[model samples]
Target: MSGLAASERSVRPSSGLSRFAAMFGKELLELVRSLKLIWVPIVFIALGIMQPVTSYYMPVILEKAGNLPDGSVIEIPLPTGAQVMAETLAQFGSLGALVIVLVFMGTVSSERNSGAVSMILVKPVSPASYLVSKWGAMLLLSSLSLLAGYGAAWYYTGFLIEAVAFKAVLSSFLLYELWLLVLLTLTLLLSTALRSAAGAAFAALGAGAVLSLLSNLFPKYAGWLPGALPGFARQAVMGSLEWSSRFGACLVATVMLLAALVLLANILLRRAAAID
Candidate 1:
């Protein structure tokens, strides 16, 4: 009997993993059908290219404007490659984050409202599998989009501006990607917790804004928060960041918070399925 029980325990995890893969595949197919896989990366790449291009051409752009006097000289100092790359990430922090939130805002709630989740729950599928599948898909999408965008920005910055160290760019990318992950996870959590997709998006974005505001207003206190990630990313690019012990603490805290949110989302989704 002990041998049988042990065998059953081993089988359970394999089955669960299969279910998660199936669900993740379905989400990926849906993303493709919705053209999210195409347009999102395109948008990100556009935003990335815009940053370095605009930075490189600022003087020309200013001179082209009709308001400039004939003898006026625009001697604005050009930003370094690292600075340009940091500015590119700033684009992602604002508009790119919004795009991500809006795209996945309906990931779970829409299915719940449409009875799709009910259909799935009626089967033997685990709620944890369902939530994890959604999270995994979003993570893939976020990582791919950000990588494409940041790579483009890095290339442009090197070509137009000075060359930034690859190590610096990579470090900054990882840090900023963490910030994106937190925002994406927050949106997913909100989607499970709220019925309205718009409400979920608004709440997530609002929370992000509040975090950013607090971090900016009180850097000494809020430096350990996830909101300070962008600052850390910038510092990485500029090679000015001291590898503080708190940096690891903040990373761990952010990850723990994300895990808690995912767990809560799973529980809420299970309850929602029962109610339906």
Candidate 2:
């Protein structure tokens, strides 16, 4: 305790912002060291590009896939560029979401296990600073990765299929990005509250799956839930949906829900009796 107290006095930030900046920088550095900064975007690009390429070549693939009966014909309609983009995002919501959860599953738990959280807390760090720093780093990586992957898909969709409206693509990307953030936030919440990183990942995925299942069961009533975001993204791509009260309500409600989750995470960390 005496050594910790002495170390705490050795370096104190002038303000809360400085302390947060320090912690945020550390988190970013850790991400780079883990090589997550490189491979995550690459994987997303692979997943993003696969959708358009496969959709464009489905006829050729089908013909060569296997030997059909003597006079077999499989005439399938080629999807538009907008449809392909929506499909790519659906891929993201499934596989991309899983990659993200696994990538960040140990965000806080590892720190706790290594005793870093105890040493850091002995200093002038606030729970908000600590949690926000980790989240901000993860969010930054996610934004960049999503942009690279989605941009590649849009470019290829234009080359192979019809070109989607830039406005619609942009709108869809923003909505999907927020949805991914909500998933990451849920993972962060569990990572902070639980000791097992794998358990945190599974629980977060299960909760999101349940939410999506319920929203599918009750669209009109569940529009305000985060599960509505994926459908909203698809609507943005299809250009069928408009800026209506339902959309507005869902948007505002999602933002509020995101903030509430962060506040709850802060309380959880602050009240935590042990980091390991």
Candidate 3:
């Protein structure tokens, strides 16, 4: 009895929470090692600064692009800070989103292709813990990148143009972050399901594009989709977003879809592991 108790004590398992934290730390360490934690945020900051600077100097640039016909006045009005900020968000939606999806698209697929995922699953970690660790780490990186970029954009916009309201910018940031979470989670889900990183990235980006196209084509009918999040975010920056049933539904739908993607990714990874 004494021997059995000692053996059991010696081999005692780690709590789920401990395993989760360990796994999350491992993911973060991987990000650091890969320099993703550094360069991605830098890219975002550069993107943020570009919008205000480019908008501020557009008239000057055009003036120097060769003399226009005399009296052919290009009376380009300077954009307000909120408009410039909105353009920055649009830049994020396109270029920044592509960068983010591409960076993370390989996370699971590369691990699985190299048998690292199988090795990971062989340990005493639950699939949920493993998947969520990746998910949480990616989310953390996204938050840091977005905040750095948004802050840079806000500062530059205020200096170069009019100052955007604190409340409006904050609201836009929260909404846009939620939208980004939904986007990244979808890419992560595809990465878990597909073995080809490029294929996963392509599919996720295509799906996002389709959703955005549909929302633009049918704004009244499709405003509740996740694609509408950016428009709502733009409205937030412009102080035009309102709390209505439709907006509430869109918010709830995005959250539900996020939860569903995380759950589905966990299930897919488990099924794949079981097959292995």
State every prediction's TM-score relative to the real structure. Answer: 0.93, 0.93, 0.95
Residues 45-73 of candidate 1 have per-residue lDDT tens digits of 99999999999999998889659879988
Go through the candidates in order and give the clash count of each: 0, 0, 0
**lDDT scores in order:** 0.89, 0.88, 0.91
Question: Which tens-of-lDDT digit does each residue in 100-206 have in candidate 3?
Answer: 98999988889999988889998999888988998898889998999999999999999989899999999999998888888788888999999999999988899
Models sorted by lDDT, best on top = 3, 1, 2
- Cα deviation in Å at residue 228, candidate 3? 0.5
Report the number of the highest-TM-score candidate.
Answer: 3
Off by over 4 Å in 1: 1-14
